[model samples]
Target chain A: MAGVDMDMQILIVDDYKTMLRIIRNLLKQLGFNNVDEATDGAQALQKLRDKPYQLVISDWNMEPMSGLQLLKEVRTDTKLKDLPFVMITAESKSENVVAAKQAGVTNYIVKPFNAATLKNKLQAVLGAF
Target chain B: MTDQAETNGHEQRLEALVSRYKDIDPDDLVNIVEGIINTAQGDLSSVNLKVYGEIEALSRYIHSARQEIASLRPDEITDEHIPAAGEELEAIVGATEQATNSIMESVEAIEKEAETLPPEVAQRLTDSVTQVYEACGFQDITGQRITKVIHCLTHIEEKVNALLETFGEPGERSARERKANETSGAADAELMNGPQSSEDAISQDDIDALLASFD
Candidate 1:
């Protein structure tokens, strides 16, 4: 965790306000303070287009567009491509995971996950962050 | 008289006797007819001919509804219960979400102040706060489950209403029920539905394995 920028701008997206708050709080606990929020995939997509974020953490079951769709969009966009994208959702189905992986996800965390799991996942994805 | 003339006269008198009871012994004839109707049709004599069509319609409606809801017990499950159940589940989601927000706010405050604490104490506080974060996830899971229930209740209400429409004069839905149907969002994508409880559903570990190849 030593050399990880604590001020790295992270975007957390979910339709559920409680979840967005929970994930943002956990990220804050991990020492990442510059976090932004979007309630759904469409808004998250618009935000990504407008800003430069180091990472995007999104939920999978949002309306109009899902996290997988956002991941695909990010991968396809020349500017947003190569960004570290993690999916945190209650959609723990295997097919959902496979779809996310195929669409190019940096990491996928299931719901009801603790801070330790989140930390390890983030560390693995962001290289010890 | 001719044989044909005699036959015609007999037919005319018989028709008069059948069609016009008012002409001969009106009270006596009424009593006889009422007795016959009671024995054969169970009080049909009291029913006005003008409303016979409405009575027949009602009878048909009851017949169809009975077939549709043979097990339906109106006394046990009144018309209001299904919608009420859906509303209650929605309220549960709202309450849990409010509670979670309050908890998260407190945790955030604690986390901020933990920065100044000594490493050992701050580490313990962080651990406790981490547990709280994980516990708060209960709201998300339970919210999904409750949403599914509300969908089911909405479905049952629709079906029951469809049947009940048969028992009464059909009319356009009231504004409140119309608003409810339009707002339910029942047509959303079902493949990425809320957490599944069926045997066919996969688990977190299975999801992890699917993503393991990426690592």
Candidate 2:
């Protein structure tokens, strides 16, 4: 879903650098130019504070810190609060989903999702669809 | 706990059946049907009472999901009936994660209990764990390697269980297979990421020489 002229900064957080690159390229293809990358939740937090990002696309599982943890941290922090956050995961676990929802994730996308599904989930999170 | 050897053997038979399904008889269909019926009768909802129980669990999940959504203040919250899907997902993912955790726990328990046994037994347990780990697709991020490993491991696990039943020890082949896997895994990682140091890259013969570790 594209509005006439509004740019949004999207932060892609994943432990796998390859996954981050893939998501970054995918978002760029979708016409979102302002994009950033982080390897884990902690790094994501640092980046979030260093600059403002309109959206966050994160993986559910990672060492040191997790996507859910990042979501909670983002929601709890006053400045970064209300940022549109999405959880992308291979884990379809109910508790994981519940946990993500509880942490204020704007939406959840299961792994192996296509570009269409990614767009749909983003729209759902942004309330555009 | 159920006998791992028995389970492994059962899985191997399942694998053989899946791979050679074209050869199975029309009569075997009756047994397969019976198995499905039995599982559904025991594990699936056979009556309203069981269905109600499942719905109750689902309702709780839905309620929580709704509360979370309301707080996010989206542009418009479409009633996607997330709880219904959430309920189904909870059951499926919860069961899988529980099963995996249970198996890992059993392996850990066996390892701990076997500590007092001979060194050979301990080695076997370690190898068994390694086999299961690889089979479960721990190393490969692509998920294909894990799928193939799981298929093979399921067969091997069944064989290992049977060997344990007969010999009072895990199967030797499982450990040997695990060792082979480890060697190949290291080689695979090297190939994908390249060697840790340039000095290790002697020649094509050098790569062949390194493979001796697996052998």
Looking at model 1, residue B169 earns an lDDT score of: 30
Off by over 4 Å in 1: A2-4, B1-79, B164-171, B174-188, B198-201
lDDT of 1 by residue, A1-129 (tens): 676777888999888888888898788778898999998788999999998899899987775677777888999999999999998887766767777888899888888788888898888788776
The ten-residue window of minimal lDDT in model 2 chain B covers B187-196
Which residue pairs in candidate 1 collide? none
Best by lDDT: 1
Global Cα lDDT for candidate 2: 0.59
CAPRI classification of candidate 1:
acceptable
Task: Give a tens-digit lDDT track for model 2, residues B101-186.
Answer: 56655765675676787989877875565445333322113432233344354455455445343533323333223332343333
- Clashing pairs in model 2, backbone N/Cα/C closer than 3 A: B5-B161, B8-B157, B8-B158, B9-B158
lDDT string for model 2 (A51-125, tens) is: 988889988665456676678889999999999898776554444455556667677675545556676667656
Docking class of 2: incorrect
